[model samples]
Target: MKITRVYAAVLALTSLLFINCSKGDDDNGGNPPVQETPTIEGTWKVVTNNYFEDSKYFVINEDNTLHIFYEDNLGFKDTQNANYTNNEEELQLTINFGYGSLLANYTVSSDDLVLNFPDGSISLTKETTALAPDNWIKTLKIINEGNAPWTERIDIAWNGSQLVIGNGYEAEAIGLVNPETFALEGTITTSRHAFAVEIENYDDEEKYIFQSDNGSNKFHMYDLADNTHEDESLPLGSWIYGLASIDYQTIWASSNNEDSIYLYDYDSKTIVQTIDLGERSPNGLDYQAGYLYICANGQLYKCDVSDGLEVIESYTLPDYSITGVAYDGSYFWVYAEKNNEGKLVQLDLSI
Candidate 1:
């Protein structure tokens, strides 16, 4: 009887140990399998093709939202937003532009994302992030040119309530019909070519103009209040092709022949700094916010004028020559000389 009892106790202990071991395995089994949902969430770059040779990029959010950015063959950068979805293998994206919806497809690979469009397919490598969009307000073209058409193009600037325009040879003033309308008000003729125009700092009550001749080594300044031009010039030793005001007292000018930018103090009329922008022919300069924007050889560039005039970013256009550039607080307006058409392009600056 004693032997049987001992055997029974050992059997019961063994059963308990087996039960505990089974429970421990059930509670803490090796990590469960990692299940992946059929979702593509991240940024994607668009492949280069005939229509978009410069390469476009896009971003996809977790909630099915999408943003597409590309530069058209015309050298214009454009951006559009929409929604996207993926079903196991194929991806479908739709962009609604009020006028219509644009549909596109994509096939994802291990290291590549290819966009399949109606025309052809574009393959893009998987990148860490998409490119930022361009910060453009609006583009205003000197369309009518005060009803008097001229052979050469003119640059424009704003001085309080007046609109100032400068041709290579003269500076003209116009009255603002509204914020967008310009009517011929007055004209100031200069002996030298007025390549660029800017409002001088500390002279908000008056207008100071910088005029540069084609081959002249110096740039001249004129005062609208006194109706007199100063003989003093900023000797760049090269042609002053374009001019823009950084602020009320600071001005920046670009030289095509020298391939440099000269920053001058308006009060002292002296050179403060200079920036060499490589070998590109720089022209049509305008300043907005904190950037010095210039159109050179059909491409657009933005540089920081305050510090050392470092190039922050650059973009290319399909066409190679732009006559003039203007910003209406929002978008970058470019006049295509090759096509003889005005293009108001929106740039996406999202990083």
Candidate 2:
């Protein structure tokens, strides 16, 4: 899934790839202690993130399993359960979070433990208190549901008071709802499925609404200032399943049947970067600061934008079908739809 590097930084980063930790003195009935893999089982807390601190934690148990836990501000709990294999060097984590096993460069140095991703890295500290065994991942709570039976993608945007949602499959409408009360505002139809919607006010006339489609693979840029549209389709060359605006000029989109995401520069009217994700069907992407959280295959991935779309952390929603994700500084707004039933949940990342 590697593509030709267009930037020098990406070319230089080809050196930091994770190597198999199984490199040690051959072990037999007479294995030396110096070549044996050290124990990495214990508790680790997230130490660095652009948005929040101490919000994420993981417990790597010696029982060949690991638990990643998240507690939101509202007391809702979310977690990931995965099987792990530590080959005396690297921990091959088989996160049932969709994409199966992920090889992370593991290094434990005193107070800090680092797991390097393909392009980015995550630093976890030794937790002062080990979490209780019974205190593993908890069941999620449903906060709100869309008024209309949402049949398509459930990508949402926050515009201060209300959440503007993209409408149904091949939708001819866009919906607005209060995030707090789930009160529905009047929906306006436009004869296109707003499969993915992004809210941006980047020094424009006012806030603008950007839509990425599932059917036409086009972009419908609507100016909220004048209630007019600059509807145009770009050569996506694939089906776009989601959209997220990075700024006024740049927006990111996810493609289905392809493992890569496309960086569309609306100002330039061209595809800037076609990010290659080795995993298939990159869907429902949202950008905040330097990270992009994407929902695909029931897994939520936190990706670093500086490098080649490297996944820093991936959390899987086992048994649950989560479709989209959005990060708004404090919390990660997660969405799920089943049988035309739409539900939105808020995860307080500050917690």
Candidate 3:
């Protein structure tokens, strides 16, 4: 009786051990671990080609919605609202347009993104959405606050000493402003309407101011020695909005009507090169070192000096209309208008 009882106990213990082992095996093999999906929620700057398609970017939100900006066939800036579904391996975009759905294989790293489509892949860098530093300090109030027309202050240039301003409403003279006091110390009397002013200071002996005539599609050159126009005028087919001088032989002029910058040969009095700014209306232009700083659409753009003139950097300014930009060795003097008030703002290179 005792041996039978012991044998029963051993069998019960063996059954319990076997049941637990089976449960462990089932837990190990019954299901696999799930993987977390990769996230694609950020603003991305498109850098597929060497030149930046400024109109092209992606703004993906957390709610599966996105905004894609691009230039249409009509050369107009356009945006598309879309819903996006992203996984670890694929991304699907459902645009509001007639196109139903488009899929692409994508990869995301720390700061880089690559979307592989049927044709090719588009490369993008994650854009930092941090607001620009508040480094712009207003130094002068050039225009009063009210319903003043934008033509009150048009352009500005740093002449190594004072600020030469173009008063678009005034047809007879350009004002020479004292940068220190923000006062209209003197005026350069000329017959041409001053819409844009640039100083071509080859040397102390040969300093001249180039002004774009607002009354007509033309430009005039005035000698600073006597503040005289010398009757030197050139026919500009389009409305020239800004001018910048490189040397005694080269000058750059921006045309708002044509959305292009013309490289004029001062000696030949002819346009040697034309840089097309693809749909961007350039307002003002200034040159420093080898880069061209452009004021377009209330922002400042820095472009290279090469043939392509690829935009290297872009800075967002205050919520004001940027009319002109000038670099004065240390600070950047910007002519901005807001609430019908125009001012000369001084900003450091931090922007």
Candidate 4:
């Protein structure tokens, strides 16, 4: 009887082990989810290749033409043109140019881009892809904020389906307007005089930002998930004129009365790096197509973020006081105000 019991116990233990292994192997039942590869038709700055210190950039377009600009260490600049073909299915690229044809393989995961060549591999970082600078054409006029006329130093941002508007002249509230018709939806009141209003969208919720003048905590964060304003003690400084972010934590802000962009650390709540905007006052910024487009000096300046926020392109707007700017995937909406009256303008952008 004892031997029989021992045999049954060993068999049960083996069965349990087999069941556990089977459950582990089929956790997802089949293949895991796959993320889509982002579009790669844009400008890329060479981060690493054969040349270590030389500045190199390539404008890869959908028209089979690649515009190359290179600056050597001796301050010599060269402009080269080449024709290229790509096979997205096979991830292969062939360049036909002056001397001969060179074949390469490329892959883009998230924002990092890699081009593998026959001679050597080139790792490029995206500045702005599939964005044309010259294609920004004005698309009629937009209406005004419904509740009241916009005060001075008006700022604009997009939060989900609405445009959040703020101003520096009033210590009232942040106005939410329809992005299409500019009709007022609602308002989120604040006790501080707000200058910049921006939102950081996460997976499930959004964190709204209401920034003020150079007084105290310059900005206050409001989370949509809990519907509360974190104003007990903000760990940041003042004079934060503009705010934007491609990612949630790496918040980039422009200072008031200064042509400066500061990378704000969320945890530390301090300026991580201060980059010179090369202008007197860089205000009202939005991060679009890997560039920080700032409404400053009566124009929209595209800063090459991959090159230390250097102004690469500027689009002249009307002579009115332009307060804020926002990008809505296909078009750029700018806030132009004069004497408390505001007008939203849509711009069609191209390269």
- Pick by TM-score: 2 or 3, better one: 3
Whole-structure CA lDDT of model 2: 0.65
Q: In order, what lDDT does every prediction score? A: 0.58, 0.65, 0.68, 0.65
- Best-performing candidate as measured by TM-score: 3
| Candidate 2 deviant stretches above 4 angstroms | 1-151, 201-205, 231-233, 317-319, 338-340
Q: Which candidate should be chosen as best, given lDDT against the real structure?
A: 3
Question: What RMSD does model 1 have?
Answer: 10.5
State the lDDT at 45 in candidate 2.
84
TM-score of each: 0.51, 0.58, 0.65, 0.54
- Compared with the true structure, model 2 gives a TM-score of 0.58
Could you give candidate 2's per-residue lDDT for residues 251-342 as a string of tens digits? 88877757668888888888888876654566677887767777776556676777566655556433456677665556667667555567
Q: Put down candidate 4 lDDT per residue, 1-351, tens digits, no spaces.
A: 999999999999999999888876776435575567675578887888873245477778888888666554322233456889988899888888969888888898656778887667888888844423233323233333333346566667877677777756663667887765667778876666677777773444555464554444456666655547863224443466677866766677777555566777665665677776443566788887677777765556666777555656556544455668876656677777655566666666632
lDDT of 1 by residue, 32-64 (tens): 655554334666666566544454776667777
Identify the runs in model 4 with alpha carbons over 4 angstroms from their true place. 1-148, 213-217, 231-238, 338-340
